[model samples]
Target: MEQTKEISALLQLIDDPDEEVFGAVSEKIVEYGKPIIPNLEDLWENTPNETIQSRIELIIHKLQFTDLAEDFRQWNVAGHFDLMVGSLLVAKFQYPDLSTAPVLHEIEKLRRNVWLELNNYLTPLEQIRIITGIIYGYYGLKGTEVSYTNINDFLLNKVLETKRGNQLSNGILYLIICDLLDIPVKAISIPKQFVLAFQKPGYSTEEADFASKIEFYIEPASGQVFSHKDIESYFKRISVPALPSYFKPLSNKKIIQYLLEELANCFDNDKEHYKKEELLKLANMLD
Candidate 1:
């Protein structure tokens, strides 16, 4: 934005010792939206004091977050929510300046590799075998146990860059690729696990006979396939009932919402509590 005298005065008062005054200044600055981000960045560069620099950083983050929240709102209302785009938005929460081109390119490369091995004659299991082989075997995408301490594991871009992610992120990446390929895989509502289900032909999530819809269950973290018996054994071991709702396929929006809620947990510390709040707010928008 062209630096008006009012904006200049607000920038100058960013270092004000009074918290109430600074708060007022921040609200006014944020009202200018993202257009004023470059000016804030310039001010951050020239600022000397670490404390004041932190203040400027907070204001800048607020501006970016306000914009991001709007993006999430729009994603929710869109006729069809693209999983790749939704995941990238979560990545943008932490990496405000993230370049999506690299991420998209890498995903496209993986998609092409998988596509080469796929043919119309292949069975559903065969299709999954090919995808799992390319992604986990050839590409070496590793799935680690979920850890809130490792924030990158929850981000799609970082997951792709490092080739390692927890179950949720790896599962999400798996879903995104499947979506691009027009596969029938979906994330299910199984408790304590991020599992995918390969739906049978001529059946959808809304159909009756929940058990009949799924060809099999897949553990995305390891690309391990599970039979109905295996899933039954799991429920018995966990002492949880095998409820039909647990087998229902989760919508793409719900999957992203789960990601945001889990990502929010990584920011529970005193210094990052605001991040937790913002992430939860974004998650609620998906609801």
Candidate 2:
């Protein structure tokens, strides 16, 4: 609900466009600088209605914008995070190809079928785990060419059916699964490896998991489970450069750091990455 005075004042301000009022507001905002924020904030909280409080809060936030200088500049310099994040999301679809068994879309359809099968057997979380397995099963198949369409019957029926190891690409496919499933699955990126994290709403409240190490999720295409040693080896392979002091066991903090790196990779600055669509996909996996 809106407060009458705030709406009336807002309408008057909109209609009149009083330079005096604007000047006064701007001047006071400039004068007290950051110090005035608290009082304005107090007024905002004291406001009786939601709309009025929101308006007042926006004003206060603007008044306090100077403090955001570093953040804003960083956002601008990063080439804007949104484009980066968007690119990253799309980039994962690029994978090494094997035999020309099928086009990308057909494989996608088969993958989706297997995923639907996996979904049938387990709880949401368990579904995610098995689907992750099913995705890896597609690896080293007759097809690697990626597209929005295409299917390899042999790979779908034979390759995955035969292979036992779950690959990391399953996690990549998990992203799409998440998109479809509406689960709270987050992919954390490491220099060489990746860790996937998932959180979900439960009957109680919230639950989070970061137990699966990068190794637990292997890339059969590469044929190795990622490990701390693997990260060092990857850096060494890239020659970015030298060996580090120590390799640590996987931790949730590392998951968060990796997640941020992913955001950094994706360039999701100044955007609402959280949305119903993303959440639903995650929910399917995380639940």
Top-lDDT structure, candidate number: 1
User: Candidate 2 at 185: error in angstroms?
Assistant: 14
Best TM-score among the predictions, by candidate number: 1
Candidate 1 lDDT by residue in tens digits, 1-287 = 89999999999999889999999999999999999999999998998899998998999999999999999999999848888999999999999999999999999999999998899999999999999999999999999999999999999999999999999999999998898899899999888998999989887666656777899988888898889999999999999999988888888898999999999999999999999999999999887
For 42-63, candidate 2 gives per-residue lDDT tens digits of 6666667675565455455444
Q: Each model's C-alpha lDDT?
A: 0.93, 0.39
TM accuracy, model 1: 0.98
Candidate 2 residue spans exceeding 4 A from truth: 11-131, 135-233, 240-246, 257-287
Measured on C-alpha atoms, candidate 2 has an lDDT of 0.39
In candidate 1, which residue ranges exceed 4 Å CA deviation? none
Worst 10 residues of 1 by lDDT: 203-212
Worst 10 residues of 2 by lDDT: 147-156
